[model samples]
Target: MTHQQILDKLSSKYLVKSIDEDVARLTYYAMCFEKDHNSQFEYIFPKLMLRWNCVLNADKNTVTDHYRLITILALCIHLHKYGFADKDLTAEALKAIDKLNEAVVLSDDFFRKSEEIKKIISSLPVPLKRKPSIPENITFYREKDVVSIQLGNRFYAAYIHRLTGVNESPVIEFYNGVFDKVPTIQELEKLNAKGRVYNDGTERISHFSVSGMKFLPDLANQIKLISACVEQKPPHQHLEKSVGLYIVMDIFKLQDEIKSIFKT
Candidate 1:
């Protein structure tokens, strides 16, 4: 999950909008722990410490310490929700939580002093036993590969293309034409030449990273690459430096927009 998705989920779930970067990052790690609990603390703790140290090293201030305490509180809350027992929590984790409780008692911040953070923590949803349904046998596709999605009785085609950058990622570009059956690569190529392509709201080609999708399991399964074609060099595009964390596309939301466009 991307950091923005984690922040949005945390905000909506807790009905609180005051989450800072530290809280979001710690919550993300907590979720990662829940997903890979069998990995043991030896593996997870070092990574957590590394992440924590990086943030602290980047900015050393009293405000950073305050955020760190809040993050620790949020992590402990999530860990308990995931059914971690006292024995399961490490000494450091226990100590951090104790520190958070002590800080909360003396803190003057409106959210902390009023115990709103505690209320929000207590209101977290019941934990799930499994992560989001990503197919066990996953297939990674490269540029020029054709994929399909079935919406009702009609099928839509898309082709994969890599963006030009240091951190290039595969993006799926959807065609505008609807098909009675999955179209062949040759047919999609012809359609592409005729300018039969879907453009997103920004007037850019309708594209997204498939790995970022979290919901719409049926659509996810149907969108696997169907055919591989010749690799064409991707066009050059300017990339912007992301300010905070990466934003993940919600494919379920994208599916809704597509359905509305086709009135399906």
Candidate 2:
């Protein structure tokens, strides 16, 4: 189920007066943890720790709202995963559980409503897996086809050059010109001949994975070969072994490098 649906069900069943934005976000993160273990480690763990620290420092009179209760339950679940062996962490978990029990006291004081809430959290469904970075249906470009590269409002140009590296992976060679708009094939050819290499005189070329290549616009009409302004050499000798090392050449890094080179 989607996180929103889970939140709605929780709100309706528990008669939660209002859903705070922080509670909603934590619920989403908790559901994400249920879906993928990697997401829990990479994204949710640090945030959960921070929330737990806040609970520790909170004043006695501070209101323990829905957000706090959700945080406590998430912490309890996380501790349960670690086998609950750390004495201090176990004490903190027990303290948080007590706070939840105190905050959730009903009229008769007989119902351990916190236990029911924990059961609901434990039963949240695992969500669908995430989609791939590059969709399967997108077409790839052939050699010498002009492609537009977008960086925020501006556009740049590059083309699918021949295979490089020991593995014979395809590489995209970027030209040294930025455009206010997407340039046509003829305009790109003119830019290519301007002999505008970087200050170090090295041509800007880098390997990209097929997934990373999806960011470049699809191939332009087949055009005549645009020869390099100078003798072309490998941009970085250390990157000769494999395309994996060049993953850092993704678009954002390229944008920063281009901006720094031109001082734009």
Candidate 3:
């Protein structure tokens, strides 16, 4: 799944739950922000300028891991307010601007000050580091070329290619959504043995921590089954998005926005 697609999948309220739900929503929103980073310049500027450098470091164990870091940097590098849901500070600030701008005439400094104040308020406690250069896959047959792989476009692969400085067109064939042998729900249920923290407003995960395969037929199961089926085969043998990397991207996006509120 391309970064956007990964985020889009995880954004479903159905996939997230528990303490992780907030994190997941944050990730989804941040992925959107990365797509159109400058659209809300007033909101994102503070993150880019102030906060991102601290948590992110260039070093990673794998191209997949490295790609994830960059995505997080892109997503959370800038936060606009305390949070993005419901009543975010940025929304309030935007409102403040609407009120101020409605006055018809004002000094350019006033507008400048608004921007300045936002920058200050949204500044990250520490600067985010630039993502490290992508390490070349030294292993033989690692398939350095993402295009050659049948897997569609998980964000990790694409982001890794970008980080490693690989300039290839996005791999879209994976999204056609086909598999050599689609597993039955019975088979899928067997594979749905693992669980992760979800920040879900909607009930998604049927299994709890260390719990047996809780039987909830939500998208989470389908997604995981697809992921497992794909993972069971060679990375080349499966579809791209089934990698399940998007779940992490979903959370990263939200954290970046939250960083904004903590700025000043």
TM-scores for the candidates: 0.35, 0.33, 0.18
Greater lDDT among 1 and 3 belongs to 1
Candidate 1 TM-score, C-alpha based: 0.35
Candidate 2 lDDT by residue in tens digits, 59-85: 445424544544444444433432222
- Model 1: CA > 4 A from native: 1-139, 163-169, 193-204, 212-221, 231-248, 260-263
Q: Report the lDDT tens digits of candidate 3 across residue range 153-246.
A: 1111110111111321111111212233333333432322212223442222121011111112321111122231132211222212233322
Query: What's the CA error at residue 238 for candidate 3, in Å?
Result: 12
C-alpha lDDT of residue 164 in model 1: 28
List per-prediction Cα lDDT, in the order shown.
0.42, 0.40, 0.27
Q: Quote the positional error of residue 143 for candidate 1 in Å.
A: 2.2
Please give, for residues 1-264, the per-residue lDDT of candidate 1 as tens digits: 322332343323321222222223333445566555545333334433333332233234422554544444444444444333223333444454456556663234432333443343444334445443332222245567666765545677766665223224345656656887667766665554112123332233345554322211221134445577746322213222222232233333345455654556
Model 1's number of clashes is 0
Among the numbered candidates, top lDDT falls to 1
RMSD, every candidate, angstroms: 18.4, 16.5, 19.8
Model 3 C-alpha RMSD to native: 19.8
